[model samples]
Target chain A: MPTITVDGRRLEVPEGSTLLQALDELGLLMNGVDVPHYCWHPKLSVDGSCRLCQVEIEGVPKLQIACDTPVADGMVVHTTSERVQRAREGVMELLLVNHPLDCPICDQAGECKLQDYAVDYGLDHARTREPRRPGRKRVELGPTIVFDEERCILCRRCVRFCREVPETGELVVENRGDRSRITTFPGTPLDNPYSMNVADVCPVGALTTRDFRFKVRVWDLDEVPGLCTGCSKGCNVHVGVARGAVQRYTPRRNDQVNETWICDEGRLSYREIGAPDRITRPAVRDAEGRMQPVSIARAIERAAERIRAAVLREGPAVVAALASPHATNEDLTELRRLLDGIGTATSGAAVVEGEPDGLLLQAERAGNARGARDLGFGDPGLVFEKIRGGGVRVLLVMGRDLLAEPFLGGTDPLASLDAVILLDTHRSALEQVADVVIPGRMLAEKGGSMTNHAGLVQRVPAALEPAFDAHAEGAVLARLRAALELVLPARSEGAA
Target chain B: MVSTLVAQAPEATVLSDELRAAIDREIARFPEPRGALLAALRLVQDELGCIAPPTARAVAEIFGLHPAEVLEVLSFYNLFHTEPQGRHEVRVCTNLACSLRGARTLLRELEEHLGIRAGQTTPDGRVTLGHEECLGACGYAPMLRIGDRYHEELDGPAARALVDGLP
Candidate 1:
């Protein structure tokens, strides 16, 4: 470890650590005194392009860029010195010369680094009397990203992010001097798996997500640490919510998993939260065979009564449960308990996912396949085969539609079954066939943790009240378990 | 999401046989191939006289760089051209020393004679006229460099004579 004294305090940071990383470890960033920067991101390479991070190192004639400077033992650095302040002022002035000064209309106004640093250390008046350089106001860089040329400070954080992280060198700084702007190849667009991360890395309003452009201000968003349920990777994210709905999902830094970057698919999965067809009320097939809405208590009671009738008619072996990999571990635990209480066999959870890109996107769709298995969910093929073989009559689907599964030999798998009790978060084809349809909650409606494919358990806090805030899947399972225990005495050895 | 959209892959390289051999030699010189991007770009410019989009992609294939990076560096230097320009490019030194003498007046005369502005090529595409910051020949004021050679100590008649001589 090398010891360095900065602005007065002395701290020993790990060896081979850059001065910026060392200083950040000292807890000086956004603390009492801050070293303003634009291009120097924690996860990216040290680019000394942005000279605003210059600090006065003792015995060095010129101010050194702290980002590229290695922290040596007994080094004395002054960030608040007169020389450092003047350097920052000069750099900020030159950077603001061609700037469009559109913070009033810019979406990145409140959280923008340029806006923050200008107020802290920049000069109010611009010395240049020349006209500001005009540029394209709304340049569509890709399907998801929008580029504003005038607002760009040429920090190159987004460019480096594309180069270093995803290794997709699509974004490049075109031209030089005042004419420089970030662009992709002539025909190729910035449509990489981790492309939206550029919007987060961009220090200015130059790069913004097309999905979030002019939608909701940053301050208006109520952010909470959450995990993305788009895949089994369970990428840690900050759920940005407004008006009781998820506005966006920004990846939060987790050294173990997603390092401050999320896949575009996972980031866009927040759109499904407020999408139509979300189940808001419990429903049951009435005497006329039409699904009718009912209260949560009535739905659970009716579902339990149907399950009991099936167990009474034949036995517990007649029923089979298919768990959803998308459900949280907490809900899986309750489902497992409820199935154990009913003494029925489980067909296991469906894998239903796309091919893995070998990066963050896992093949098991969404969250908690490993946890479902840990709770002893068997193979789904067995359930499908059993349902196809006409050996099973009463079917219990938890948070998934297994009838539509190809493995279930989709010859009306519900036709042979007498009753189908489904716990779903959305109105699906299963609703038309299921005898009892109890409403379940989405990832955003409940607080729970799920084990990722890597076995790292990440807790996700509910960011918004779901469109249907009726009952969580766990509560529904708990009620069903209680109702089953009250009626059946844990049917033994397939006894009728 | 954005990743779901299809991105057009770059076409097969259109680098010439001789240019490919030259780029390979340039790549062998550097410890890493990407380090020869600048040198490879220079060779492309010398061979093609300009770095067009397709030529840039060809060079990028050799250097393993994004074509946009080559375009980024291509725009930084005045020596390298990206688009098809005049047959003979003329740069009039209008720095402090050249302007103090008579470089601006000489440039105006040449523009009038050629019927084109300082930064534009003639209608016939014979010559491109532009003003440079400094040619490092400040000692010899009022100088204009055309093609590969520099003509120093020039007046309005001398500059016009040189332009008129260009066929």
Candidate 2:
């Protein structure tokens, strides 16, 4: 352990801890100690660009970047020295020399790092008398990225990311001196799975997402830390919502899973949450073939009674439980307990499979298959085999969209079962075969915890009210346990 | 207005020797001749003061690219002018950092002085004023680009003088 003093406060940190780590440990005590930085996100690898985190060391002659320099035992760091402040201002000035002034229309206006650091350390008056050398302006690098050459500070963060993180060499700086600008080689477009992250890493408005350009301001957005439901990888994301609608999704740092980048498919999947076809209410088939809305309690009671009747008449061996890998561990645990109480041990888990590229999108389409396993559902293949064996008379399906899965042997396994009960948020082929369908809320509409593939539990909070009379899967399963007279242990509330 | 007339007339069959020389030099610098499309277009824009579709097509033909490709690059990059403009171009950097320091105010001043909004040339065709996002010059809050030069730390008076001084 090394003890370091940051602004006169002594703290012991792990040996080789960066000045940033020590500052992080000090917490609120060092609030006024300003540090300017960009391309040095806490979640991402140290870039040391922007030179904004320049700090004065007790003995060092030159200023050091706090983000890159590790702390030494008995070391003293000063973040608010005049020399360091002047250095940051000078760096910001040089960065702004060639940068275009297009903030009124730039998408990154509110949340851009350049804007924040400039306000903190940049000189009030620019000394440069010569007109800025006109650089490449709006250059459409690819389908998703629009590059503003004048806005680029040559930080190389986007280039480094394309090469290091996603390992896609799409962006490269061309020319030199005043003419240098970030560009693709002639006709090569910046097309990659993790291409959108370049826009996220750009400190200035140089790299802008074509999909999000001019759509919404960053300040107006309210971010909800959640997981991407596009695939089973469950990349951590911060869903930016504004005016009761999801505006955009950005990757949140989860070292155990996505690191600092998420795939474009996951980034754009917020549109699906706002899809027009989402089911909002609990509907049951009434007399004369008319579907009527029922109360949540009534729906639970009717579903429990039907399951109990089937179990009593056909025995527990005939009752089968079908769980979706999209559900959280709490929901799966409660559902499994409720079914197990009735003596039904044969449970099946359904997971949708997609194209696996070994990055971003895995073959598994469900985001919470690992959570399902943690709740004792076991392998999905076993569930498929049990359903095919013809021992199951009643099937209770939760959250799985069987139609979306082409390799599920064409939904014949579901058709063979008697009295299929579907509990899902969307309309799928499995729901059509289901004798009773219960509309459930989407992940964003409910509060629950999903244990990602890395086994790290991440909590998702409800950003808005349920679209209709929908309820959280955990809440629904809890009510079902009450209806079936199954006593289960309660899970803790709040996000992990 | 006279510059627009000259631009429209297609006066001489011969390209300006200076313009031809600049394009030739840029084309010679590239390993693949077509790689000089952006550079050549910028050179032509500098010589003729605007990039007409025909001139852009001519540049594209020299580079073995489609005229649309050349046009796309011109439209995509903010520098090359697609339309005839005043003798000088005034582009204000409006990226995030500059915006926070009141680049919008500088833009308003230029617009008021030029009597035209961004992306439009003055009625007399003496200057083309435009607003660009970030020019990566965060330290120089409220900066504007005039011709091949950058004027930083600009207020209303400073921005107006820079625009007014444009040839």
lDDT of 2 by residue, B1-167 (tens): 00110101212234677887888898899998878877887778767888876676567556655344465577666566666887777888988898899998888877888788888887787888888878777897878887778888888987776666656
Q: Which ranges of candidate 2 are over 4 A from the true structure?
A: A1-5, A10-33, A39-49, A65-75, A124-129, A286-298, A354-363, A380-386, A401-407, A486-496, B1-167
lDDT of 1 by residue, A1-496 (tens): 7788988988888799988887676666657657889999988988889899999999999999989998899999999988899999999998898999998899998889999889978888888899999999998888889999999988899888877777777888877777788888787788787889999999999999998999998999999888888888889988998888999999998868887789899999988778787777788889999989888788888888888888888878887888888888899888888777787764698766678876789888858888778778846888777887888877878765354445453436676678888888777777767888887777877879898988988787777777555677888889888878876955433445
Give me the displacement of residue A327 in model 2, in angstroms: 0.8
Across A189-301, the per-residue lDDT of candidate 2 in tens digits comes to 67777788999888789888888888888898899888897777888888888877888899987767887788888899888777777766666656554556777777777
lDDT of each: 0.83, 0.74
For all candidates, state DockQ relative to the true structure: 0.42, 0.02
Per candidate, native contacts kept equal: 0.41, 0.00
Evaluating just chain A, the predictions reach TM-scores of 0.94, 0.87
Worst ten in a row by lDDT for model 2 chain A: A487-496
Q: Provide the TM-score, chain A, model 1.
A: 0.94
lDDT for A316 (candidate 2): 66
Residue A292 CA error for candidate 2 (Å)?
4.6
